[model samples]
Target: MKLTSVSKSLRKLRIPAVLFRRLAVAALPLLLLLALATGCSLFERGGSSAISHKIDQEEDVISSNGGVISNLDKLDSFMERGSGSQRIVQYTIEGDPIFIETRYEGGRLELSYDTTEDAFGPREVKTYSCDKLVRTEEKHQLKYSLKGCGEDMGDGDLLTVDFDLGRQDKFEFILKYGFNHRNEINTVNQNLVKDMLDGTVIEISDYGLPVEDRQSIYRKLVLSNYLGEKQLSTSCNLKPYQSYDLTVLINSAERHYAWSECDTGRDGKVMTEAAEYIIGLVEAGDSFLQLPAATGSVK
Candidate 1:
């Protein structure tokens, strides 16, 4: 009986020991797995998002208020602190005018017109004259840019005219804006385009446009048809381009155009033709090549 009681007590103690071992074996792996999962979560969320968000936020802040870039030096310093590609564009609106003197009416009639450009100012008078053959009523209405250019800039900003000295001559797409001329903040986009096309060094004014727009202008002007066969010329003889920002459409007239309309409709045909012409010129040029900035600090 004493031996039996001893054996029973041993069995009870053995049951508790086995239960403890079972509990430890099941719980250890779960604890290890939880520890590993916690570490993975922390790694997945480390400073990456904060850093990205901070940069993105700063870019947004600058872009939203790009119009008032009063301090060029401070802007230069900010660029010095960053890595990767950075661009700063600067252009001044000198009140210079653009003049387009061309042969229109199938190169039969000669026309000369002075279109005024001063962005911060307005004009009610525009002058047009046909120096060649004329028979019918002379239409003297100064042409404003028909392109969708009036969105940010106002009307009469860009001038266009179709006159018939005898055979319906047209002087279209004339640019006369320069340091002596002034253009609104908007049409200067085309000036940047042309400069890029001609390989001239225009300190781009990231003053109002984003990087994408600047690059888009580069692509368009670099490969545009409107500028094809068109030389970036200074108005040498008749009158200088004064009181404007930059002159575009200096060679040919721009037809009423819309990009979306062209891929699916009619209006883009003129723009396409112009772009095609410009592209042809690009192929034949010692003119413009993209000057990707020196890979270093902005300063």
Candidate 2:
């Protein structure tokens, strides 16, 4: 009678156990997918056109960890913007080329390097982005109110001009990224005549050169000097610590809109007579990475 009762109890429990096992098997994939979705929610941006994505948390090892980027969940969107083939700009630190991760989107470029992956030992991880072009009113102590670059450079970082902004003839700029941080008058300067609109007389320079004059001197200073030309050509002057490095044409002549990079030096200091007019940067050779070549397809 005891054996008979135990057998009946065992048979009753078998169905429940089989059902539970089946449920667990079915739920495993769903749980894994949820985890991935959660991981890709970190990147953010103010603009809709730009690829705004993030990686909610910083977890894992240097090579196997996750951090936020402009496009996290929709990495496909980024790949779509570029050719699957990519360019790896490799440069050396003291001797070895520091390995870095890089990406491009919305007409901007960004790179990252983790010291944990470098010979220097585990240092902080970094993410870089291009800064927006800006111009300030001279001598007016113009309260520097500039637009944010739509997205943040993650945490533990800051924003700065990647390339120097210069003025040509008040018009002509040589290479690219040279005209960073230029000062243009309010687009509505004409509307702001002291008597016409309100009490504000934008004192026109003797040659009627306001920001134009500033840019003219900038181009002229760097124009005649050899170092000036070289500084403009080689992206060496960009500082390693500076984030949001971008070039903006201060004048009409510089409208071509071009910027390039070089493999040399460690700091982004460049000697240019332009600052006489302004050219300053130190090349941080620690810039480098490894990837397949770009075939010019917009992904």
For model 1, the stretches where C-alpha displacement exceeds 4 angstroms are: 1-191, 194-256, 282-284, 290-299
Candidate 2 ranges with C-alpha deviation above 4 Å: 1-18, 40-118, 121-299
Give the Å error, residue 45, model 1: 92
Please, what are the lDDT tens digits per residue for candidate 1 over residues 95-124?
Answer: 333232323333232223322243443412
TM-score, prediction 2 = 0.22
> Each prediction's Cα RMSD?
27.8, 21.4
For each candidate, give its TM-score against the true structure. Answer: 0.17, 0.22
Worst 10 residues of 1 by lDDT: 57-66
Number of clashing residue pairs, candidate 1: 47
lDDT of 2 by residue, 1-299 (tens): 12244345556676587765665557556655764676532233222222212222221111111111211212333335552212221223443333344456565545555433345544345556543223333432212122344456433222111112331223333221222322122122321111111222232222122454444444343322222123233344655211113222444422222222442321122222322232221111111112122223211
